[model samples]
Every structure is written in C-alpha cells, then in structure tokens.
Target: MNKAVFLDRDGVINEVLTDRVKFVNRSDQMYFFPGVAEAIRLFNQTFDYVFVVTNQGGVGLGFMKEAQLQAIHSDMITSLQKEGALIQEVVYCPHKPKSGCTCRKPNSKLIEDLARKYDVDVKSSYMVGDTDTDIIAGKKAGTKTVFIGKSDPLADAVYPDLLQAAHWIVDDAT
Candidate 1:
C-alpha cells in the first residue's frame, strides 16, 4: 500500500479572502500563498501520492457554477506545476453545508474514496488542513493529521503554515 499526503485547497494551498468575497468566485481570485507550491513539491517528493481535498460549497450555493470552480482548480494546478509540484488528484465536495453529504470534511468519505482508489494505507498517510473539520476527517480516516495554523489537540502535529508542516512531516517520516 502507498502512503500519501492530503491537503486542503483553500487556506492551506491558497489564500482565502475573509474580507472580500470568501469564495474563489473567479479564476482570477485564485492566489497561491507564499511557499505553498514549494511545500507541495516537498510533499510530492516524500509521499507516494499528494492530493487536494476541498469543500467548495459555493458551487451548490450558486455563488459560482461548477465550471467556474473547475477553472479555479485548473489555474491553481497549472501555477503549482510551474513550480514543480504535482498533485495526484483533487477531490472536492460540491454540496451545500447543510446538504448532509458524506463527502464533506468531518465525514472522511472524500479521503476514504481516494484511499480506496489509490490503494493507500490510511494509517500511513497524513492529512494537512487548517480547520477542525479537516482534522476530524483525517482522524476518522485513521491517518496522521497535521493542522495548519492554530493549535488543535486532534491533530498529531501543528504548524504556523503549510511550509512548516511540510517540513515536519518529511522529517518525522525519516
């Protein structure tokens, strides 16, 4: 079985605007946080698989169409590729928060599905995210968890940002 790293899209890989439009309503709104590509590149080097697991509820809420969301992801991936980062896949839940979807974070279905598809060893994988929901999903999926920003008891590790978290994960694996 393969070991992998699961990353959250917004706030972890890219910036999330809290003051302005919270969602990346347009591709132009997509902005990579400093060192994110480099961090992901490190993950690419260390993990058998690197994936993006996100919740884009804005699509179901009509803030943006599914095509618009795809465009944003495409732009994000293209930008990361320029920096030598390769993401194996991007799994997202495109449902409203109240929709009771099993694919959303806090459910672990997204990570579980990816693990099944890739034959990943969930216990050997790491899920990195900035929110409690992300930590919850990772824990439920039985992977070691890294929480970016703020401290969380549920996470196996915590860091100020993705770059630092990436470093710790790589170091701990060795």
Candidate 2:
C-alpha cells in the first residue's frame, strides 16, 4: 500500500492568471508559487507518489495547443527537478467543461486511474487543491482532502497555501 498526494496544478503549484480568463496558454505564463518547490521537495520525501491532476481545457477550447501545454509542463517539471523535487506523473483532462469529461476535477476518474496504475492506497492518500472541485474529487476518490487558499466546508483540512498543506501532511504522517 503506497501513499500518494494528488495536487492541482494551477493555483496550487503555479500561480493562476485570473486576468487571462483561461488556462495558461503560454509557457512564459507558467510561474510557480512561492515555496512550491520546497513543498514538492518535502512531498517527494514523504509520499510514495506525487501526482499532478489538472484540467487543461484551454487545449480543447483552442485557446492553446496540446504541444504548448506539454511545453509548459515540461518547463515546470524541469524546474522542479532542478530543485530536487520530482513529480511521478501528471494526469490531465484535455476536454472543455461542457464536454462532460469524466476525468476532470470533481470527477474521480483520473484519481482512480492513477490509484490503480500506481497501486496507491486511496484511503491514506491526500488530495490538495485550491478549489472545491478538487476537494470533491478527493472525497469521491476516498482520500483525505486538503483545500488551499479559502476554507471549504467540505474539505477535511484547510491551509493558506500548498506549503502549509505540505507541512501538515508531513507532520501528520509522523
């Protein structure tokens, strides 16, 4: 039984461009939040698997190409790896919100898929995200939910940011 952490990309790992009104369409727009590298480095030491679950609807809506998204992820991963943090895998839903995608946030399909593929113990895992949809997805996947940013009534725990959430997870595991 392996413990894993499922993290949301935008707003969790990277800064979200609220003014853009769409997904991060350019690699130049991808910037990691403060302490995100340190948090992920801690997660690398704490969890058996660290997975990123994101919804890149921009690709489906023609806001950006899939290749551009890949480039952004590549840059992010490379930057994190340079800081000694490794992300095991990144799972994304490349569908528009109206596409009825089963793998998007608020749906456990992607989480379930990762659990099966990685032999994860869902019960002991954690899902950390900035939105209620992330909390719902974690709940549906049978993992503890940690909400970043504003508090959510449905979340198992709330933190001001991903770094705080990481600290809590590490401390709780011990």
Candidate 3:
C-alpha cells in the first residue's frame, strides 16, 4: 500500500480570499500562497502519492460551474508544474452543505474511496489543510492530520501556513 499526502486546496495551496458579495469562483482571481510549490515538492519526496482533497460547494449552489473550477485547478497545476511539483490527483466534493453529502470533509467517503481505489495505506498517510473539517476528515480516514490555520484544540499540530507545515514534516524526517 502507498502512503499519501492529502491536501486541501484553498488556504493550503492558495490564500483564501473572502468578499461579502461573492465567493471565490474565478480562475483569474486565484492566487497561490508563497512557498507552496516548494513545500509540495518536499512532501512529494517523502510521500508515495500527493493528492488534493477539497470541498467546493459553489458548484452545487450554481455560483460556479465545474468547468470554471477545472480551469482554476488547471492554472494552479500549471504553476506548480512550473516550479517542479507534480500532484498525483485532485478529489473534490462539489455538494453544498445542505446537501448532506457523504463526500464532504468531516465525512470519510472521499478519502475512503481514494484509498480503496489506489491501494492507499491511510495509517501511514498524512493530511494537511487549513480548516477543522479537513482535519476531521483526516482523522476519520485514519491518517495523521495537520492543521494550518487558527489554533484548534483537537488538532495534532498547527502551523501558520502550508509552507511552515511542510517544514515541520521535513524536520520530522530528519
């Protein structure tokens, strides 16, 4: 079985932006956080597979189309590839919170499905993200989870950003 790195997209790879009028729904508006690519590269060296697990409810709400989300992801992938980082795959739940979807974070369906499909050993994998939901999903999947923003009492570890989180993992390897 292969070890994996399950990452959250927004606030992990890119900085999260909030606006009162609308959610972030455009590729043109997406901005990657600093050092994210290098950190991914480092994680890649230590993990058998690097996957992205994200919850994108905008699609369910009709705020953004799947094509638009793909475009945004494509742009992000292009940027990461330019920096010599290769992500294995990206899995996302496009259902709204009210949908009560099993794939949403804090639920194990997405990660569990990926594990079954890819022969993943969740016990040895790591989940990195910036939200409580991400951490919760990671825990449910039986992987070690790292929280990246706002201190949480239940978090295994906390970091200011993804880059620092990567540094912590790298330091642990040494």
Candidate 4:
C-alpha cells in the first residue's frame, strides 16, 4: 500500500482570496500560494503518492462550469510540474455545503474512493491543509493531520504555511 499526502487546493495551495469575492472560474484566478510548489516538491520526495482533495463550492453555486475548473487545475498542474513536483491526482467536491454530499471535506468519501482506486494506506498517510474541514477529513480517512496555519486550533500540528509544514514533515521523517 502507498502512503499519500493529501492537500487542499484553495487556501492551502493558492492564496486564499477572500477579498477577490469572485469565484475562481478563470485560470488567471488560480494563483499559487507562496512556497506551495516547494512544499509539494518536498512531499513528493518523501511520500509514495501526493493527492489533492479540495472543496470547490463555487461550482455548486453556479459560479463556474466543470470545464473551467478543469482548465484551472490543468494550469495548476503545469505550474507544479515546472517546479519539479507532480500532483498524483486531484479530487474536488462540486456540491454546496448544504447539499450533504459524502465527498465534501469533514467526510471521507473522496479519500475512500481514492483508497479503493489506488493502493493508499490510510494509516500511514498524512493530510496537510489550512482549514478545520481538511483536518477533519484527514481524521475520518484515518490519516495523521497537519494544519498549515497559525490560527487553526483543531490541527494536530500547526505551521505558519505549507513550506513550514513541509519542513516539519522532513524533520519527522528523519
């Protein structure tokens, strides 16, 4: 079985644009957070697989089409590849929070699906993200959780950003 590093997309990978107030429907809006690619590269060196499990409620809100989301993801992948990191897979829930979908964060359906499709060892995997939902999903998936923010108290471990979290992961592995 493979150990994975699950990541969140919006706030964790790209800058969380609360003020942008607009849904990220275009590739231009998909900007990488500082050191995010570096963090992924570090994980790629250590983990057997790296996956992205994100909650994209904008699609459910009719703010963007699925194709637009794919375009943005493609651009993100291209950028990450340029940085020498490869995101093994990207999974997102398009349902609104009110939709009660099983795939949404705080739920483990996405991880479960990935485990079924890929040889993921839930017990040995890790989840890194910037939100409570991300930690909760990791917990539900039976993986250790690392929070990528100084403010979130729900995380098992907290760091200022993804790069710091990556450093922690590297330290822990040694």
TM-score of each: 0.96, 0.95, 0.92, 0.93
How displaced is residue 83 in candidate 1, in Å? Answer: 0.7
lDDT per residue for candidate 2 within 1-174, as digits (tens), equals 899999999989987866643457887887777899899989889899999999889889888888888888888888899999899888899899878878888999999999999999999899999998899999999999999987799998899889989999888766
Off by over 4 Å in 3: 18-22
Task: Give lDDT tens digits, candidate 4, residues 68-145.
Answer: 898888888988999898998899999888798888998988887887789888887888888898999988888888
Model 2 misplacement above 4 A: 18-22
Q: Which ten residues in a row have the lowest lDDT in candidate 1?
A: 14-23
For candidate 3, the TM-score is: 0.92
Local accuracy of candidate 3 as per-residue lDDT tens digits, 8-107: 9987887666552235588767777788888999988887788889999999989889998888888878879899988878889999876888999989
Better of 3 and 4 by TM-score: 4
Q: For this target, which candidate reaches the highest TM-score against the unseen true structure?
A: 1
Across 18-104, the per-residue lDDT of candidate 1 in tens digits comes to 664466889777877788988988988888999999999999898988988888888888878988998888889999998998898
lDDT for model 1 comes to 0.90
Candidate 2 lDDT trough over 10 residues, lowest sum = 15-24
At residue 157, candidate 1 shows an lDDT of: 100
